[model samples]
Structure formats: C-alpha cells, structure tokens
Target: MKWHHVQDNWPAFFEAILDRWPDADEAELEEIDGDQRAFIAYVIELTGQEPEEARADIREWLSGELPSDVVMDPRHDNHSIALSKKYVPEGEDEYDDDSRFGDEE
Candidate 1:
C-alpha cells in the first residue's frame, strides 16, 4: 500500500480496536491513544533528518541527559540490581560468558 493510504486510514485503527472491545477502561483507551500519537510523532520527526545528524543528536541527548541510575521497586527480589550487575558491571564485560564465543566459529 502507498504511504498516503496508510496515513489516511490510520484513524480507523482506534475504531476497529474499540469496536472489538468496547468495554475497555478509560485509562486503557488513553494509553492506546498516547502510544499511537507518540509513534506517529516519532515517524514524522525522523522522516526528514539525515542519518548522521539524527544519530549524533540522539547519542548526545541520551548521553548528556539520561540518568545512569534507576529507581527499583523493592518488592521484587531486586532483579534490576542483578541485571545491572551483569549488564553494566563495575568493570566492562565482567559478567559476560566468553565460553559461547568458542562455539560460534
């Protein structure tokens, strides 16, 4: 299908889903709407920028602004702490299992 056709028919998405499950709560509907808007806005934003500019801007923004720490829910067995320890170690690749590399070749 053409791009314009897909864009034009986008509004029908809400009706089709809602028609299937009309009893969905207000919060659920709002979430669906918010996701749709965010996706569409992302597509629009990225459509025109050059790849280099987009990548550099995104990298700079993420590196300079995003926090290194995250708040974890203490209810869980602190899975976040465990995952972070493995993925983002105090030293690089500390938790990585290098044994898998020998099998790949």
Candidate 2:
C-alpha cells in the first residue's frame, strides 16, 4: 500500500499477522516488524500505487499462497533511500525517531 495507508493500517495488519502466527517468538516478531516496514517501503517506492490498489495488493500478498518477502536493500537503491528519508523528520534525534509516528518522548 501507499506510505500513508500502510502507516494508518499498520496496527491492524501487524495484529492480523500475529494472530495468524500465534506461535511466533520474540525474534520472529522482530522479523515481522522489519518485513512489514519493508513491505510498506516496497509498495511506496516500487509500485507507486494509490491506497486502494496498495491495500488490495497487500491483502493478496497476505493470503499465504506466496511469500511475503520484500527486499529492503535501501543501502543500494536510491529510490528506496529517498522513500525512507521522506519519513524521517528534520531536527529529530536518530534515537528518538519514533516521535515521527506520534510516540511520546
């Protein structure tokens, strides 16, 4: 989905995946978080799809028939780096980056 769509629906999407894989351990949960972020980045950078189209794509991908493996190699891809940078707020401490998402300090 688009960046905003993913940002808005991330909690639901994350919960759904967790429900599907209730046996996931701590490391698996961390991997899931990374995968979800990578999926958001992929949809924004590669597809350029609007919210509806991106949501449909996400639903299809989450259907379990295909792998949900999104390559998150931002270090090598300028487009990925640009997309990621768009979410980084200016004048924010790198360690406090969660504030961009409205997390409290």
Candidate 3:
C-alpha cells in the first residue's frame, strides 16, 4: 500500500489515531489499544455514529491516503505549545557537563 511509503518516512506512527479522535483522551486510547470492538464502541458512544459507519471511518483513516496535517513530530504539533514549559532553554545545559547522562548526581 502507499501507506508503506508513508510509514517508511515516519517510523514512529502506526496510525494517527489521536488526530482522528482527539476527543478520545490518552487513557481511553491506551485502553482501546487496537481492539476494534472497543474502539467502535467508544466511537459510537462519543459520536453516536452507526457501527458500520464507525468501521468505515476506521478503514478510511488507516488507508493509504493519510491526512497531510497529522504531525509526526510532537515538537511541531499544536499540543507542543502546552508542553513547552518542560523544555530547557537554549544555551542552558539540562545536565551537568561532567555527568555521563542526566542521572541524578
């Protein structure tokens, strides 16, 4: 599938599940975790979509023609703005130079 090429470009993404169902919070997503029935049920519960319609939506989402706006890099995604506070400022070392890694000294 053409998606093979897309996957080759972004090894980290198996699906843009979050992008498609942003209302599905992280915890629920973790629980669903590729279980088709669970996902379908959740979709129906949240959106009142028919079972067949939900299945079709999933198929289209996983198809070769992936959406262009789904971000592969979290740093560039809109959600990144909320995470910026955790980022270390430029010209500042997050770890001491003498430390082998960032392990607590």
TM-score of each: 0.23, 0.27, 0.46
Across 1-105, the per-residue lDDT of candidate 3 in tens digits comes to 244433444322334666777776667766665566776798887778998998788668767444445445755553555455468677764442535665446
Better of 1 and 2 by TM-score: 2
lDDT of 2 by residue, 16-76 (tens): 4445434434444444454555654555444577766766766765654221233235553
Residues 12-93, model 1: lDDT tens digits: 3344334433543444444445354443344235445565554454334324311222222473335444566656746765
Poorest lDDT segment (10 consecutive residues) of candidate 3: 5-14
Q: List the residue pairs that clash in candidate 1.
A: none
Question: Which residue runs does candidate 1 get wrong by more than 4 Å?
Answer: 1-47, 67-69, 73-105
Q: What TM-score does structure 2 among the candidates reach? A: 0.27
The lDDT per prediction is: 0.42, 0.50, 0.60
Candidate 2 displacement at residue 36 in angstroms: 1.7
**Candidate 3 local distance difference test against the native:** 0.60
Clash numbers, per candidate: 0, 0, 0
Q: Which candidate number maximizes lDDT?
A: 3
Winner of 1 and 2 under lDDT? 2
